[model samples]
Target: MVAGDGQGKNIDDLPDEIILNVFSFFSFNELIDTAQNVCVRWKRLAHDPVLWRDKEYIIRGRAQNGRSCCGVTCSECAHCRCEKTDREVLRTAGSMPQLRTLTMMRGTRARILRKICRNCPNLTTLQLHGCQKMNYSLLKYIFEKCPKIEKLIIANNLLADRRYAELVSRLEHLQSLEVFENRRGAGPVLLRFLADACPKLREINLSWDYHPLEDVEYFVKAKRDTLTSATVRWTMAGKRCVVTVLKEAASSLEKLQLHLFDVAPEEEAATFADLGELHNLRELHCNQLCPHRPRLISLAFQPGRLPLLQRLHLPHATGLPDDAVATICRGCPALRELRLIFATSLTDGALAEIHRLKHLQILDLSGCSGLGGCAMAHVAQLPALRTLLLQYIDDLTELQPSLRHVLDLEQLRCLNILNSGHIRAVPFEEFAVRLVNLRELHVTYEEEDEVFYKNVFAEMQSQMPRLRIINTFRWTEDDFLTDYETDDDGDDGDDDIGY
Candidate 1:
């Protein structure tokens, strides 16, 4: 393409920096398969290490893509689809010697990881997810190869023993560490290692259970000045660690998530009360709340308290009243996202207060059974609102009033109304007409009405060609019995249908 100047200069006439900047937008796959073959200059620019510094190469498996099993490697195996992809990834990783981050997903072979590790010496972040039985030797090999790694995440993977901690402690440059799962072997020993050895650690997310309160408190206290994000699961016996986190890391802590097992009513109340002073908090999620609910109300209800909070997730606010919601909305002026999932006791009145949140963009009121169609009027008033989730909400009938309110949301991009039975053909058609800005829509239908709604969805898709619609069918009790009905030969017809 020629530049629109009098000289009619071609793209190659531009400086190498400008051409490389343009090349940066292309995906690694595009760079390898297309750009590299485009021209000599383009290929050379495409191979620049600066482009791959933060590009995370994801290596996922067939199970992740909804398959039973990825192909097995036979003795005389021609490379399977997965094997081909792995070979491509290793080749790409080898080219990018300055690669900073690599994410290997489920079913990643250890040999492939070891190869990538040895190639990318400047690697700073390594994330391995859902690849179970990750022994210490593999981790040790990775650490030895990528000595400059700063952020490490091993989520949903089963670890062998304490050697996981032993390997992690060697990363002197480590800043962020996340090893989250219920079935991990690491306990308080991991926390002890992090507190003692890893001085530069600023973020820690360990979802392992049975971490004693004393060890938890000591770790946070030790790194109070540097720790910016902390997610820890501790026993209920030492709930005072909540206070320690709030008090010690009050100035520096930006994100805080605490998971406590077997928490009593009074202990929950105390924990909520202690959260009043964390002024620097940007995100907060503590599942359990006091029965009184007023303790949390005070923290969020007061002016200038938790002023910088952008996201507040309270999933267990089962019986939260209207006054509490009103107070939260009134106080947290800068809140961009608020999730009050399963707050069953809330009514449409709470949303009226939420309309005051001028900067709010994402709101999730899923499982708020008490909310009806009328609440959407207030929800639609949020100017910056883009994503709204109202899954399993009761009485969201497809009436003119509700449909009109939802259509008023001109900026809405994503809407999820999963299992919301009352919203049928009329509301969706109305949405297809007015909600043109919508990019993604998730809806569910009962088994009996599936075919009818599928047709309705087809028409909607034609009207809004840019929209992505995800359809789900909620099976009825009768459908289950029909599937198991015996035939004349005493054979169940279930074998013919795939679940």
Candidate 2:
């Protein structure tokens, strides 16, 4: 039943299913701290096991005595906060018998962790972040307690022992694993152990300071048939291994990330060619290798090569050619999100082809200085366009026409024009009034004076009170002095701009 029906009923009159559905949106802390005290009905529903199952309980922040904060904001209390937190976790874990995912961040105490894991018998996914105290014994204890764990994300921990590999290999049910900054001397041994032991492993993300070519290739080749997603980072010395990973995982790979830096010229040219053959690839992300290189993207991005490609991110892609962008736009018609930040070589011709992506929703062309007003005008024509980030484009000086075209997109919710200093305040304010559906506006000017922008901003606030306007422009002390020195009677051209 509707809460505000003509019978004069309230939310308490609603069915348990509807109330539980609303309660599902509340965080674990909110449910325990606030919802449980609301009413007798809500108190019972708050303790329901379904509410806690499969939820990601993130334990972060500083606690007294260097223990995990457990979402509490107490520094000094009569009772020991650490023991209180441990009791709370143990009690919460009893309510979450079906809990599947548990995430623990920095400052988590050993006893508290053991208490939660021992109670959460069905826990399958464990993510440990910045837990410096997580040694080999603590991890092994966790593995033993939570034997059903299938996915593990251990980041920025202190597990530098090769003996940790022996414990990891014992998890026969493990399917996905992500290790970052913990595999210093044990990376090679861990990969070798995982290849032979972890039969169900389908996705793996390994990131550290350095990657040995021999170890990476052997692991990739061995698990190529089962692995569907891989995130591998390497330097100039491991170029051949990068190619081997792509070549081996081409058939089954659906998601791939290559964080290649300090790459040799010849190896860089040969490595990118293998990417075009991955027909099953749905998402591809590559980091910048060299800014001075003539072309970072390969010419192999032709039609029908990557037909299933949906998302492509090439951040800091310096010297990226316009034809490559054109080819990606034409070939990857199923593309939904595209981010080519700092790709300076792109022009209007490349952006013109981008409108062909009928399903495109998010487009971030930040720092592409080569694009001008015409390129932006074409980008605003995408029907499904919701987020448009055109930051750091100095050549987009003609704001009035571009803003007029942009305001026509009824679905456009976010527009980012940060660091584009040439935009006039009056025209921007005028066009912003028409973009009624716009939820976010990110704009900044490099001009010294702030008087003109201040007036425009005030007017915008009065006109579009619901719109979120983020301005990164900073005014200097000289601009304030200049404003005070100038006569109020003097013509500042505000009249000519029709403001």
Candidate 3:
């Protein structure tokens, strides 16, 4: 029987499955305050097991002047306001017996840790961000209550003591652990404890202050067979320790990111050579190393090595020559995403070889001053390119033939041309007409007048309604003064001028 609410068809007449699916789209606050109150059937469906199985709650802090103080310095701000309290979230989560994944961000307190442990015993994934009040006791409560948790992400928190490690070691079923920006350093004892306690752990991301070389070596050696992904950002005390870890985990490691500090020149050659052994490595990100070191690139990147590699990020790698870029293109044929920001040595010759990467989806060559129009010509040939970031390219004037080729790609979603002052508005307007699928277009030309942008935007909007243009050029002092004068002239005679 189809039911009606006088004027239109009734929503209650829909089947329970359809109703539940509709309610699933509603946020937690909306379901509780509006949807559940519509009718008894809607209320029941809102509380169904399927609706609350995977819960995500974002506890945002108060904002001032439209700027939110949610994650950063929320605890320090006295005026911060949260929509739901810790106890209230626990009470709501406790009512859902089938809860499996819980992600709570910002404003999480220690008091709710025990509640989560006692309430959601079946939780397999627990992610908590910007938890200011987290401590040893709260973590212990989680270990005792949520024994089945397999993946844990506690980032930007204050808990980084020995007790925190001890509590983490208690989670016997732990498979993945990501703990970043903690207060204290991850010492040798803590590393050893984690290695011994969590034998099944396959992925670990630790961005703490320091980890002893010996401890890191031991941990890597222990998890060599099981560990597939690891991100370590710490001060380099012993370079050989890094080499040993990479050599040991060569066969199993698939993704690796290392940000080392205070690296000596004597040990760099050996360290870079060790990277070649990781045949199974897929993604490699090396950041903030000693600057102007070209030998490191030559030693590490060898042909026929890292064939399965997909993403390569080498930001801050200054003076990266064209030969190095050629070596990378030849070595990593399966590359999907490549970022060589600030690599000033690369020229058009390097980009010529990049077109061969048919599988390439994202290419970022920002700050590569050596590249010219010829390089962009090759970029236009990438069949699968989706995102192209070319900021601060010195010789990039106009996207002529390249613009047509880029518009041809149906999958090209984002194009960033910030600080590329040579590109005129006319070619861009034409490009916008054919790039119907393009979602984001970022452009900036400081020398051009506001009228130029207004005309370009108006024309582009008329052609491609869905394209989002991000204008990054800031107003000069002259422009601001001119606008003030225009506003003054528009004022009536009765308007007072305060002296």
lDDT of 2 by residue, 372-434 (tens): 557657887798998988787664664334545777676888888888667662256654556
TM-score versus the correct structure, for each prediction = 0.76, 0.76, 0.77
Look at candidate 2 and tell me the lDDT of residue 149: 84
Provide the RMSD of all predictions against the true structure, rounded to 1 decimal.
10.2, 13.9, 11.7
Q: Model 3: per-residue lDDT, tens digit, 192-215?
A: 878787878999877554567777
* Candidate 3 ranges with C-alpha deviation above 4 Å: 1-13, 37-44, 47-55, 64-109, 112-131, 154-161, 184-189, 234-236, 239-241, 289-292, 392-411, 419-426, 432-436, 445-448, 472-499
Give the per-residue Cα lDDT of candidate 1 at 322: 80
Q: Candidate 1 residues 55-119, lDDT tens each?
A: 55555443332111222221121211121255566666566565676655444455666778888
lDDT of 1: 0.68
Comparing candidate 1 with candidate 3, which one achieves the higher TM-score? 3
lDDT of 3: 0.66
Q: What value does the lDDT take at residue 334 in candidate 2?
A: 90
Best by TM-score: 3
